[model samples]
Target chain A: MKKNKSDLIRYLFFLSAILSIALIILISFFLFKEGTVIFKEVGFLNFILGKDWSPTNTPSSFGILPMILGSLYITLIAILIGGPVGIITAVFLVYYTKDKHYRFLKSIINLMAGIPSIIYGFFGMVVLVPAVRYLFPSNGNSILTAGILLSIMILPTVINLSEVAIRAVPRFYYEGALALGSSKERSIFKVVLPAAKSGVISSLILGIGRAVGETMAVVMVAGNQPRMPKGIFKGARTLTTNIVMEMSYASGVHRNALIGTAVVLFMIILIINLVFTIFKERNVNG
Target chain B: MSKIKIKDFNLFYDNFQGLKNINMNIEENKITAFIGPSGCGKSSLLKSINRMNDLVDSCVTNGNIYFDDKDIMKTDVTQLRKEIGMVFQNPNPFPMSIYNNIAYGPRTHGIKSKEELDKIVESSLRKAALYDEVKDSIHKSALKLSGGQQQRLCIARALAIEPEVLLLDEPTSALDPISTLKIEELLQSLKDDYTIVIVTHNMQQALRISDNTGFFLNGELIEFNETDKLFTFPENEKTENYITGRFG
Candidate 1:
C-alpha cells in the first residue's frame, strides 16, 4: 500500500511537468491558429513590413513597419538610459551602502517592481507627458517620452538582478586588488565588475524584455500614432501598443492581424530569452 | 634597518579582541614569518600593515604602524597600499587575459603607455618566475591556469605595481607540496628586492624561508626570535609546544 502511494506521488510530479509543457503548447497553438489567417490574406512580407495600418479603411492596409520601428527605437532609448544607471546603481549598492540602509533600499526597489503597470501608465500620462511637452515643445507624447517612462519602469529589474550578480563575485578579488595598491574604486571597477560581466549583461537583457513588452505606459505617453516612427521628439506606435489599442473593437482579419502583432512580440521576447540562456550557459561553463 | 615598525598595536572586532597589544619590527628586504593556529591574529596583523582591516566594519584598532620613518595612518591610504602588496590563501587572478591582469596595477598608478606596460608585464612575470610558462598564453583568460600557476600569476600581478612590501597570508595553504615549494623558492628570490611578511600555520615553512619568525597564541605574540633560535632554543613553553606539535 505504501509503495502504491509513493508511485502515485511520483506520477503526480510527472503530471506537473507535463502540465506546464501542455499549457505552453496550448497558448502557442491558439496564437498561431488565430494569427496565421492574416498572413494568408495580407502575405507575410506585407504584414511585417507594411507601413500603413488603417484597419478600418475600405480595403484595410495592415503594414506594421512603423510599429516595429517604434518598438525597436523606444526599447533602444530605454536601454541607453537605464543600462548604465542601473549597473552603476547596483555597484554602489554592493560596495557602498551601509547594512541597515542597504536592506531598506533593496526592499524599496522590490516594492517598485511589484507596482502595477496601470499606476505607471497613470503617472506617465499625468506627470511625464507634461514634463516632456514643456521641455520639447511637442504634444508631450512621443517615443522619447515613452522611452523615458519605460526606463524608469525597468529600473527595479535591472538594479535588482545586477546587484545579485555583483554580489556573487568573490571578495578576495577586491582584496587582492587593494593589496596591489589599487584604490577601492579601481578594484571594484577593474577586477570585480568584469568578473560579474555575464550577470550584468543578462540583467540588461531582462530589462530590454520588460521595456519591449510594456504596453499601457507606452500607449499613454508614446502618442500611439499608427505610423512609422520619426525623430525622437515625434510620436510613435509600438507592436504591443498596436495590439492593446485596437484588440477590443477589432474583428475578422483586423483582429487576426492584431494577434499576428502579438505573435511577433512573442518571438522578440523568445529571442531575448534565448540570448539570456546562452549567456547563462557560457558563465556556467567558464 | 627595519622596514616596518609596529608599536603597541591592538585590534578588536566588535568587542572581541583579535590581536592583543603587539610590538615588532620587520627587517628590510628579509622574510618575516608569523606562525600560529587559526584565529590567533597573525593574519590580522598582516592585514593591519596595509590598512586592509578598514574593510571590516566592526573591526577597530588603535595602534601605530610605521613604514620606515613615516606613520602609515598619517600617509595617504592609497599611496601607502600601493607600496604594500598582498596575496591570500586562495589564488585570486582576475578573470581576464594574463597580460591585462599584470597591467591592472600599473594602469591604476597611471602608467598608460603600451610599451611601458609591455615592459612592466614582462619584468614582473619574470620576477615571479611565471613569464616563461605563460609566454605563449599571455593573452588567455587567467582563470584557465592551474592552481600553482594562478598563484604565481597573482604574485606577478602584485609585482607589476612595484610595491616595496609584499604581505602573504597563508599563500600556499591551498597548494600541493610541489606548488608550495615553487612559491617558497619564488619568495626566497623576491626577498632581495622587496620586504616580505608571511602569516603561516606551517612551522617547517617558517624554518625554511623566514629570517625572523614570530609565534602567536590566542591573541598575543608569544615569542619573536631568529628562525633558528626560535625553533632550536628553549624560550616560551607555548612556542616549544607549538613547534613540537604538542599543541597549537
Candidate 2:
C-alpha cells in the first residue's frame, strides 16, 4: 500500500512537469500558426525591416523600424533610470537596513509589484503624463513620459529580483570578507555583487522584458504617433501598442499586417530570452 | 608588541546574555587558541576583536576591547578591520580568480598598478605556502581549487592586506589530517609577524600549535594558561575534566 502511494505521488509530479512543457508547446504552436500567415503574404524580411506602418490606406506599408526604435529608446531610458536605483535599493536593504525595516521595505516593494498593470497605466495617465507635460510643456504624450512611467512600473521587479540575488549569496561570503578586513561597501561590491552576477543580470533582463512588452501604459502616455522618437520628449509607438491600436479596426491584409507586427514583437522577446539564457549559461561554464 | 587586550567584556544577543564578564590578554607574535564545546561563546570572543559581531542584527557588546592600546569600541571599525584580518572555519574564496582574490585588498588600499599588484600577489601566496602549487594558474577561478588549497588561499588573501593581527576561527577544522598539519606549520611560521588568535574545537590542535590556550565553558573563561601548563596542569576542575574528556 505504501509503495503504491509513493508511486502515485511520483506519477503526479511527473505529470505536472509534462503538463508545463505541453502548455508552452501549445502556446508556441498557436502563436506560430497565427503569426506565419502574415509572414507568408508579406515576405518575412520586408515585414521585419520595412520603415512605414500605415494600416488603413491603399499605399499600405508596415515597415516597423520606427516602432522597434521607439521600443528600444523607451527601454533604454527605463533601464538607465531604474537599474541603478533598484540595485542600490537592494544593497541598502540587504547590507544596511535592520531586520524590521528590511521586512517593512520589502513588503512595500512587494505591494508595488502586486498592483495591477492597468492600474499603474491609469495612475501614469492621471499623474505622470501631466507632470511630464508640465516639465516639457511643448511635447505632449512624449516618449520621456512613457519611459518614466514604465521605469516606475518596473521598479518593483528590479528591486525584488536584485534583493533575492543579493540575499541568495551565502552569509559565509560576507563573513569571509569582513574577516579579511574588508569594509562593508568593499565586500558588497568586490565579493557579494560579483557572486550574484547571474541573478543581477537576470533581474535587469526581466526589467528590460517588462519594459519591452508594456503596451497599455506606453499607449496612454507615448502619444502613439508611429514615428521613431527623435528626443526624449517626442511621442512614439511601440510594437505591442501598434498591435493593440490597430487590431480592432484592421481587416484582411491589414489584420494580417498587424498580426505580423505581433509576430515581430514575439521574436524580439524570444531573442531577449535567448540572450538571457545564453548569458546565464556562459557565466555558469565560464 | 601588538597585543589584544579585552577588559571586563560582556556580550548580549538581544535580551539574552551570551558572554559574561571576561578579562584576557593575547600576547604579540603568538598563537592563542580558544577551545570549548559548541555554544560556549568561543566564536563570539574572536568576533569582538574585529567588531564583526556589530553586523549581527540584535547583537550588543559591553566593556572595552583594545588592540595595540587603541580602544576598539571607539576606533573607526573600518580602519580597525583593515588592520586585523580573520579566516573562518570553512574555506571561502571569492568567485574571482586567485590573483584578484589576493589583489582585492591591496587594490582597495589604493595600490593600482598592475605590475605592483602582481608582485604582491606572488609574495602573499609564497608566504601562505600556496605559491608553487597555484603560481602558474593564479588567473583561474579560485572556486576550482581543493578545500585545503582554498583555505590556504583565504589565508593568503588575509596576508595580502598586511594585517597586524590574524584571527582564525578553526582555520583547519575543515581540512584533512595532512592539510591540518600543513596549516599548523604555516601558522607556526606566521607567528614571526602576526598576532595569531585562533578558536579551535580540536584539543590536539591547540596543544600542537598554540603558544597559549584559553579554555572556555558555558560563556565563562574557565582557565587561561600557558599552552604547556593548560594541557598538563589545568587549575580549574572544568578545564581538567574537559582536557581529559570527562565531559564537555
Candidate 3:
C-alpha cells in the first residue's frame, strides 16, 4: 500500500518535469514553421545580410542586418558599463563591508532587480530621453540612451551572481595570500577573484543574455529607426525591439518576418547558453 | 640567539580566554614544535607569532612578541608577514600556475622583472625540494598537483618571499606517512637558512623533526624542553600523560 502511494507521487513529479519540455518542443515547432515561411518570400541570404528593413514599403525588403548589429552594439555597451561595476561592487560587499552594512547594501541591489522592466522603460523615456536630448540635441531616443538604461537593468543580476561566486571561493585561499604578506586588496584581486573566475564569467554571460533579450525597455528609447546604427548617439532597432514594435501592425509575410527575427534572437541566446555550459563544465574539471 | 621572544602572552576571544599567560624564547636556526591535544591553544599561540590572529575581530592579545628584538605588533602587518611566512593545515595553492604561485609573493613586494622572478621561483622551489618534480610543467595550474606536492608548492610559495621565519600550523596532519617523512627531511635541511616553528598533534612527528618541543594542555604551557629530553623524561605529569597516550 505504501509503495503504491510512493509510485503515484513519483509519477506526479515526472509528469510536471516532462510537461515543461513538451511545452518548449511545441513552441519551437510552431516558431520554426512560421519563421521559415518568410524565407520563401525573401531569400535566406538576402534576408540575413540585407542592410535595410522596410516591412510596409512597396514590395517590402526583409533584410535584418541592421537589427542584428543594433543588438550586438547595445549589448556591448551594457556589458562595458555594467560588468566592471558589478564585479567590483561584489568584491566590496564580500571583502570590505561589515555584516551590518552588507545586509543593507544587498537589499538595495535586490530591490533594483525586483523593479518591472516596463517601469524602467518609462523611466528611460521620461528622464534619459530628455537628458540625452539636452546633450546631443536629437529627440533623445537613441542607441546610447537605451544601452545605458539596459546596463542599469542588468546590474542587479551581475552583482548578485558575482557576489555568490566570489563568496563561494574557499576562505583558505584568501588566508593563504594574506599569510604571504599580501595586502587586503592584493589578496582579493589576485587570489580570491582568480579562484572565482568561472563563476564570475558565468555571471557576465547571464547578464549579456538579459541585455540581448530585452525588448520593451529598449523599444521606447531606441527610436526604432530601422537603419544600420551609424554611431552610439544615433537611433537604432535591435532584433528584439524590431519584433515587439512591428508585431502589432504586421500581417502575412511581415508577421512571419518578425517571427524570423525572433528565430535569430533565439539562436543568439542559445549560443550564449552553450558557452555558459562549456564554461561550467571546464570549471568542474579544470 | 633568539629569533622570537614571547613574554606574558594572553589571548582572549571576546569574553572567553583562549590562552593563558605564556612566555617562551624560540631559538634561531632550529625547529620548534608545539604539541598538544585539540583546542589546547598551541595553534592560537603560533598564529600570534605572525599576527594572523589579528584577522579575528573578537580576538584580543595582551602581550609582546618580539621578532629580532623589534616589537611585532607595532610593525606594519604587510612588512611583518613578509618577514614571517606561514603554511596552513590544508594545502592551498592559488589556482594559477605553479610558477605564478611561487612568484606571487615576490611580485607583491614589487619585483617586476621576469628574469629576477624566474631566479626566485627556481631557487624557492629548490629550497622546498619541489623543483625537479614540477620544473617541466611549472606553467600548469598549481591545483593539478598531488596533495603532498601541493603542500610543498605552498612551502615553496612561502619561501619565495624570503621570510626570516616560517610558521606552520599542523601542516602534516592531513598527509600520509611518506609525505610526512619527506617534509621532515626538508625541514632538517631548511633550518640552516630559515627559522621554523610547527604545531603538531602527532607526538611522533614532534620527536622526529623538531629540535625543541613545547607541550600544552587546557590553554596553558605545561612544559618546554629539548625534544629528546621532553619526550623521554617529561617533567610535568600532564605532559607525560599526553605523550604516553594516557589521557586523564
Candidate 4:
C-alpha cells in the first residue's frame, strides 16, 4: 500500500514538472500563430525594415525599424549608464564594505528590487521627467529621460547578480594576490574581478534584458513617438512602448503588427539569453 | 644572522587565544620548519610574518615582529608583503595564463615593459623548476596544470617579485608522494637564495628539508633546535611524544 502511494506521489510530481514546460510551449505556439499573420499580409522584410509606422491612414505602412532602433538605443544607453555603477557598487559591497553596513545596504538593495514597476513609473513621471526638463534642453519625455529611468529600474538586478558573482570567487585567489604583495585594490581588480568576469558580464546582459522589456516606466518618460530615434534628447518609442501604447484601440493588421513587435522583442531576449548561456558554459568548462 | 625575530608575540581571534607568547629568531638563507598538530597555531605564526592575519576581522596581535631589525607592524603592509612572500596550503594560481600569473607581481610593482616582464617570467619559472615542463604552454591557463604543477606555478609567481623570505603553509600536504618530493627538493634549492619558513604536519618532511625545526603544541613552542639534534634528542617531552607518533 505504501509503495503504491509513493508511486502516485512521484507521478504527480512529474506531472507538475511537465506542466510548466507545456505552458511555455502553449504560449510560444499562440504567440507565433497570431504573430505570423502580419508577415503574410506584409512581407517580412517590408514589415521589419519599412521605416514608416503609420497604422491609421488609408494605406497604412507597418515598418518597425524605428521602434527597433528606439529599443536598441534605449537599452544601449541604459547599460552604458547602469553597467559601471552597478559593477562598482557590487565590488564595494563584497570587498570594501564592513559587515554591519554591508548587511544594511544589501537589504536596501533587495527592497529596491521588490518595489512595483508602476511605482517606479510614477516616480519617473513625477520626479525624473521634471528634473530632466529643468536640467536639459529637451522636454520632460525624451529618450534620455527614458534611458535614465530604465537604468535606475535595472540597477537592482545588475547590483545583486554581480555581487553574488564577485562573492562566489574563491577566497584563496584574493589571498594569493596578497601573498604576491599586491595591494587590496589591485588584488580585487586584477584577480578577483577577472575570476568573476563571466558572472559580471551575465549581470550586465540581464540588466540589458530588464531595460529592454521595461514598459510602464519607459512609457511614462519616453514621449511614445513612433519614429526613428533622432538624438539622445529627442523623443522616441521602443518596441515595448509601441505595443503597450496602441494595444488598447489597435485593430486588424495594426493589432497583428503589435503582436509582431512582441515577436521581435522575444527574439531579442532570446539572443541575450543565448549569449548568457554561452558565457556560463565556458566559465563552467574552463 | 636573524632575518626575522618574534618577541613575546601573542595572537587572539576575538577572545580565543590562537598563539601564546611566541618568541623566535629566524635565520637568513636557512630553511626553518614549524611542525605541529592541527589548529596548534603553526600556520598562524607563519601568516603573522607577512601580516596576512590582518585580514581576519577579529584577529588581534600583541608584541612586535621585527624583520631585518625593523618592526613589521610599523612598516607599510604592502611593502612588508613584497619582502616576505607566502605559499598557502592549497595551490591557488590565479585564474589566468601561467605567464600572466608570473607577471602579476612585477606588474603590481610597476614593471610594464613586455620584454622585461617576459625575462622575469622565464627566470621565475626556471627558479621554481617549472619552466621546462610549461615552457611551450606559457599562455595556457594555470588552472589547466596538474596539482603539483599548479603549486610550482604559484611558487614561480611568488619568486617573480624577488622576495627576501618565503613562507609556506603545508605546501606539499595536498600533493602525492612524488609531487611532495619534488616540492621538498625545490625548497632545498630555494633556501640558498631565500630565507625559508615552512609549516608542516609531517615530522619526516621537517627532518629531511629543514635546517631548523620548531615544534609547537597547544599554541606554544615546545621545542626549537637544529633539525638533526632535535630529531635525535628532543629536549621537551611533548616534542619527543609528537615526534615518536605517540599522540598529537
Best by lDDT: 4
Displacement of the residue A281 alpha carbon in candidate 3, Å: 1.5
Error of 2 at B136 (Å): 0.5
Q: Any runs in candidate 1 off by more than 4 Å, and if so which?
A: none
Model 2 TM-score (B-chain only): 0.98
> Candidate 4: where are CA atoms >4 Å away?
none
Tell me the TM-score of model 1.
0.98
What does candidate 4's lDDT look like per residue over A206-282, in tens digits?
99999999998888889989988899888899999899999999999999999998988888898999998887777
Instruction: Give all TM-scores, in the order shown.
Output: 0.98, 0.94, 0.96, 0.98
Candidate 4 displacement at residue B21 in angstroms: 1.1
Model 4 DockQ (Cα-based): 0.87
Q: What overall lDDT goes with each candidate model?
A: 0.92, 0.88, 0.92, 0.93
Worst 10 residues of 3 chain A by lDDT: A277-286
lDDT of 1 by residue, A57-148 (tens): 99789999999999999999999999999999999999999989999998988998999888998999999899999998898899999999
DockQ comparison, 3 vs 4, better candidate:
4
Off by over 4 Å in 3: A135-138
TM-score between candidate 3 chain A and the true chain A: 0.96
| Per-residue error (Å), model 1, residue B145 | 1.4
Chain A vs native chain A, TM-score per candidate: 0.97, 0.90, 0.96, 0.97
Cα misplacement distance, residue B175 of candidate 3 (Å): 0.7
Query: In terms of docking quality, how is candidate 4 classified?
Result: high
Looking at model 4, what is the TM-score of chain A?
Answer: 0.97
What 10-residue stretch in candidate 4 chain A is worst by lDDT? A277-286
Q: Candidate 3, residues B66-180: lDDT per residue as tens digits?
A: 9999999899999999999999999999989999999999999999999999999999999999999999999999989988899999999999999999999998888988888
